[model samples]
Target: MNSHYSVAVIGGGQAGLSMSRLLRQRGVDHVVFERDRVGHEWRTRRWDSFCLVTPNWQCNLPGYAYQGDDPDGFMVGADVVDFLEKYAASFDPPLLEGVEVTRLRRTRAGVFALDTSAGRTTADQVVIATGPYHAPAVPRIAERLPAELVQVHSSQYRNSGQLPPGAVLVVGTGQSGCQIAEDLHLDGRQVHLAVGSAPRAARRYRGRDTLAWLDEMGHYARGIDEFGDADEVRLRANHYMTGRDGGRDIDLRAFARDGMRLYGHLRAISATRLDFAGDLAQSLDNADAVAEGIKDAIDRYIDSAGIVAPAEARYVPVWRPDSSPSVLDLAASGISAVVWATGFHRDHRWIEVPIFDGRGYPTHERGVTGCPGLYFLGLPWQWTWGSGRFAGVAQDAAYLSSRILDARRQRFTDEVSWLAGTPTETYPQVEWWAAA
Candidate 1:
């Protein structure tokens, strides 16, 4: 509600909250503006059974870490919400929930001006921590589907019971699609899945969870710069697996073996019919290949270190589609619902800055942008694999907080120099002189 702040954090998620904790510790003047309630995505977007794909131990904020008994277990959506609530309570961050910042641009004076739902305000610096997922990416082809058929983006989906009484067609093979398909299948509903090229990962390897192995192997800490082509790495899809049912590999082949219909990438949808690419076998094979590839890397790490661990066998496909079904009659199959888990795209149009790339992604190093006093956080691969994730956001916030303070100090030094050089009569009524 203040007319101005030294720093304005543009989200109240883990990223913004972590930055607030650090700035608080450093005695910096900052406020967090959240468009919705804190952790709204975790509280609402996910399904009833939705749990963290990562282990609880990985849920580390700036000062708060998971201290529950089940460090190895995954936290469900409610658990995640509770964790964030507790973290916020611990520090009691200066957060304004339900206050949306609709527009942000640098004023003529070089200060950041924000036109929020409440009113206009300005800040010396702004941390755009709204994250990358803003728009649900439903394909335009969905318009061709019948008006009667139930359709919902993955974000709107909650559980199988929410769907109509009939077969379900889930499009996409990413984490959301796969997990939703499994949710429907387990509830005795027939599920037709349109698989994509998203890779899969092993749930566990050598008697240890693959994530645990990766954490120890320093995979999460590997910076994006470590890759030869960081741009390509940024565009890469995340390896899909599940932490549902206490964490397990989502073997699509096994799902097919159990009568869950599988198809290739969804190409088109005609009246009463749906078309798919003839690459079901390739998709499945590629997913398994990636999963195995991760296992191979873990094996090499264990061998070189001589780490004693249980020996585990590699995965083999349990079932294969006899024929690539390229088309399906929607009416005859009794498919009454469609879930579009096609993922999300960034929506930074509200930000009137010119720092975005062709894809509308902010051009930044770590979190600091080329634009002075502008920064970004909670972006996938922002610095490392865990940069956007709870496991790594603390480090990113710490680094960004230091940068913020450095910028603040530089501004103060410049102002002092200007004041000293100027005549004593000028700036006599300086409103912010005492704060300095």
Candidate 2:
């Protein structure tokens, strides 16, 4: 790669690659820097049975959509990597894999400087496309557990075979937590799951997948700006369901009825003993409510459109805790392994920019920040419900590409005007629009 370029994309994932493809199409000099080999995250972080929760038809990259015969089916872990690989090959994006960018800061020359393992490089603009799963957010209580008991963050977990021969206690009920718990449960390894307040969705309803109906309602296309409570809504835990075994709802109540022990939110830990809040019933009830709520919306949509759809009965809770377990002795209960499926937080500390809020989340309108020459991409709800997802990232990336090109043009015009004895202009503070 050259010492500098018109733009630098600091990730090689879907977002970064999409950005690269757009820039190349526009004839902009750019490069994509990936910290690891291709498919590193998919290969490492995901369990063996991991698959896309959404259907394969939703994998819409820039100019490269899914052409597989099984568009209605879910692409497993390996299939996902292959699709990305083929997309990259289709365009031959300028990418440098296995090159980690250690830090990024504004240079004295008003450009961006990226310090990487290879060396330092400068660029006119930088797009941080590293999606937000940087650091795992395991609870501190994990440290108090017995040293002999195997503990792995949800990212590190592979399969029940890798774990010791005993029961597995999975904490948290987000998508990852629920899916991992199901993974272990399917292996017939007596599983214990700690339920949280994450909502749930139906796998299929009214003779079609729930996602299909939602997509028909234009839910995926709605922008985050339409919401009155975007902040809380953006951070809300994703509804838990699985695309495994030809797509099915992970009914924790069904799991409980099938002999898997379910508990409420984990409260605290003491040595080998663990305490749980008596919210198991409430948690299950809340999840069911959300799932039903989605159906309610879909039912309304069908009625409004005057469509003839088969009616389905609302879900009834299959099992309930006769009495919520308030406490459990890990050693006595035979839980030899614990999987902390708690969610993760973004770690942008390496980016020495002041674009973050007090909580360290990047503040931006869409992907364009107030800070000139700096932008963020692939963030949760960055623009819409699917902003960070495959269905919507291409749109987000295209928006960023326009802003990047606009900024480049404005910078050029300003520099020429300044050298010609006109007063220099500070970069315009842009919000959802390019510099004027």
Candidate 3:
């Protein structure tokens, strides 16, 4: 083994592999550490019917693009895994599979020492591309639920086939939750979706891809640093409603068309029962209000941005359900399952770095971390829309690789003066972005 390389990538997924490929193109030596085989996470994702939300064309990884017949079409999970494996094989990304990184500590000499199950290794630079969706974020109220009621995180859910034959309660209004609800409804299961804030829906305006248009207009390219804090928050919040693909819109109308019931967020979960805040009429009204707000926001953004377009553009509401029902009351309606698609949380207890923020994400700029040579990629909204997604990781990897190369070049010039030393403090120093 090289013992030390210019860079050490701590993941083997699209992010890490892409970074490796970019580094290779730049003639930088690097090794990839993967807990299992390459693309293991994608291969093991909970949904059997899951397909890339971003089309195959967007799923490019470094030098190679998706060469299959369906460039614009979504690739199934297995196909995606296969593509990644092939990409790695073609590029010969230096990967150490089945090697779990147990500890990543910063040596007193400023280099990162990775302790893996196989052996220990050190590198001048480390890229933590372990990704954002580490663990599911189930609500605390779930523990109160009676064991008799089946509970499964969306990550563990494959399809309606795994669910019990009863009314299904989905506790989230995010993309995963909404999609799962739709799937269940299509499978002839009674689905009750517990929604929190309404998400921004992808509006197919005049048959154009909404996301493509946004990209062309440089929407995702602008980070929170470029836009003010308020705009960034609004953009982040709006993403919940808007589908990643601009063209294939997921609207309340679609959910309603599929006969899925939408309800207010679940307040409590008892044995085989759930409690919601608002009454049925009130819940419906709330959902409508949220949808209207999202629609208004989209219109405002388009108008302010001077996006001249026809008024006949289709607007998808964030939430749509004619009526709502209590979780307990749904039993009488024959609802029998609960799928929690409430998103994920990062678990960095094993990371052994003080670099994490309150949310457990490593504090880094681009890919540079507080500890010198320690980097991170594949983080949610790290840079832009494509930061953590499989399709977006290439851009992130390229940018990150450039930064690392620059840092590596400067390392010999001035240890303390270069890059102002390892950042002891986080950036955007505002209370919102700052670590709590």
TM-score of each: 0.97, 0.96, 0.83
The parts of candidate 1 lying over 4 Å away from their true place are 423-436
Candidate order by lDDT, decreasing, is 1, 2, 3
Whole-model lDDT for model 2 versus the true structure?
0.89
Which candidate model has the greater lDDT, 2 or 3? 2
Evaluated with TM-score, which candidate comes out highest?
A: 1
How does model 2 score by TM-score? Answer: 0.96
Most lDDT-accurate candidate? 1
Candidates sorted by TM-score, descending order?
Answer: 1, 2, 3
In the predicted model 1, the residue pairs found to clash are none
Q: How many residue pairs clash in each candidate at the backbone level?
A: 0, 0, 13
Q: Tens digits of per-residue lDDT for model 2 on 137-171?
A: 98888999989999999999998899999989999
lDDT (Cα, tens digit) per residue for candidate 3, span 354-406: 98766555777765788766778887677776777765678888888888888
* Per-candidate RMSD, Å: 1.6, 3.9, 7.7
